[model samples]
Target: MTATERPDVRPANPHFSSGPCAKRPGWTVKNLENALVGRSHRSKPGKARLVEAIEKTRSVLGVPADYRIGIVPASDTGAVEMALWSMLGARGVDMLAWESFGEGWVTDVVKQLKLKDARILKAPYGELPNLADVNFDNDVVFTWNGTTSGVRVPNGNWIADDRKGLTICDATSAAFAQDLAWPKLDVVTFSWQKVLGGEAAHGVLILSPRAVERLESYTPAWPMPKIFRMTKGGKLNEGIFKGETINTPSMICVEDYLDALNWADSIGGLKSLIGRADANTAVIAEWVGRTPWADFLAKELDTRSNTSVCLKIVDERVTALSEEDQVAFAKKIADLLDKEGVANDIAGYRDAPAGLRIWAGATVETTDMRALMPWLDWAFAEAIASLKAAA
Candidate 1:
């Protein structure tokens, strides 16, 4: 194939990175034209909007009725930190890390918090550690979906129904697109930048009745930062959970989130949202099945993430290169897509294996995913040709 005419069928929207992903299909600046940007977040209108975001999120995600949901300062990281700093150390901890984000949590618990009773269960990218090895009697901290590795725990069956301690989950990449087993989770956190495709800089923190109890009953020996503090007088700050955030929040982002939630509601709520992601993933999965040179990094169909779908180049021409050359080749494929205006930021994460990562959350249309496939093949060919020319 000589350098030929670009595919006429381009993705309508090619803004697919893993996070801060493509916004809702019809999103526009006008959607947020009425946001209370200059007003204080505590004002009646501002607070009402925030509360509406929380409620809409609850409705879309099907979070349990009793779970307490709140808006927090940082993205998903902030929400997880608050849960860890406010409610770890009363018991031993089991940290499961399959990729970068999960490993960060392990570092915090084992090295930063210096929890002597902590146990780390780790696996390389594209695989999950043995869920059965975890002792649910001890506090468990894990990511529901490994955004970097493209692997996720299949389900909550491994988590004991009657566990002794809390289950802290970093679900930034999973919520909304995947059904969370709320009964098995004590603390769940996600950023607005993920599946909903809202703006970044804020996180939603949901706590089960058990997680709140832990927060109220325990205090860590480490000094909790101002941002991580979730308790007042050793009791849960009920106001925060009711939409009174601990600090100022970007009203614009809140309004954007509301717009996204409304869009999600227009399409049939959670069940429909999950179906969208599944269909988008199926497009890529189908392509991978037929593409001779590429395969999903996630080997197990059950564990492959529907949102952050990672793929590896398996052609001998690409893989026979040195490690550094392999990464360069992967980058060239992604960069070729970018140069053609068919994709952007599709490169694998720095800490992840050399591959391509495409965001297939509900916000992304399956037609766009289908359109992107031919471009991916074109880019792969161009990248390999360039490498041969260079050699």
Candidate 2:
């Protein structure tokens, strides 16, 4: 366990933050050279680029022909906020929270929106709330994947096929790497920065026919902001779904996303993307199987995420330390890896328990994940040695 004995092979690509994840293996700035930089987004060519992005997204995600998809502002957060503000007041809502982002939505429903009949369902960082307890009679809001905790719903089997209320889902981290049951989901939202590794500040909002019906038929009691408004004069605004954005957009970022979509298409579409993510997680799973000190933060294997794979240090020596000391020890491991240029931003989310969180999405290379395992071992040994010296 000598800290001095470092691994000779390093990951060729070391950019693995959960968001703004690793780009396609061969991506370059030169790829965006044809971006419509100086033109107005309202122009014919500009709108065509936006339309192409939407069309490609629909094709790759296998969204239904009857469903509507729009690119929105403020990334996934904006898309989720728009859905919550515009639709939740129409019915009693079920809000589920198992991680930071899910908890944020709960706060908005209870504190901000002040919905009287909202039911809060919660679980700790390593687990999920009871799916059986959710009342499909009420509008349901939940995350398909808990990014900060690395736990996700096993599948969409629990959702009722004949439910009366709309199901709003914030699926920013789950869209590409996992299967999203579109029939069960009424409102689905994701960002460009996640599985596809494109730039941020934009979100993709997909809506089933039922969700559109809710928007067109019922309006929230609260005043809707201009960005959140999806209807005009008691009808759904058809232009927004057709790439006519409510506000100006970054053409450069749109081109980057198009490039990412083109890459996904070239590599065999959604099936290939899911396979890549699963393979990356398998590499980490193998490492965790033999390493006594490292374990998944997820409590159940069925719910474990293939994309944002979180790990907790279970070594007796480290666990015996004070809570603050344990956090510092985890930081030390991450810092060592950072200093050695083997990994970056592998530290867990600030609100979660002290651990490592690695991005294993479609864009991350499996070879890099294999290369990362030995470095993690080296870093953990070094951190433990440092603790003994300090004591």
Which regions of candidate 1 deviate over 4 angstroms?
1-5
Model 2 agreement with the true structure over 1-391: per-residue lDDT tens digits: 3434788889999887898889988999999999999999989999999999999999999999999999999999999999999888888999999999999999999999999999999999989999999999999999999999999999999999999999999999999889999999999999989999999999999999999999999988888899999999999999999999989999999999999999999999999999999999999999999999999999999999999999999999999988888888888988888888889999999888989999999999999999999999889988888888988
TM-score of 2: 0.99
TM for every model, in the order presented, reads: 0.98, 0.99
- lDDT minimum window of 10 residues, candidate 1: 1-10
Candidate with the greatest lDDT versus the true structure? 2
Write candidate 1's Cα lDDT for 1-391 as tens digits.
Answer: 3323457789989899998999998999999999998899999998999899999988889988999999999999999998888889999999999999999998888788899999899999999999989998899999999999999999999999989989999999999899899999999999989998999999999999999898888878888888888889988888898889999999999999999999999999888889999999999999998889999999799999999999998999988989888999999989888887889999999988899999999999999999999888888878877887998
RMSD of each: 1.2, 1.0
Q: Check candidate 1 and list the clashing pairs.
A: none
lDDT of 2: 0.94
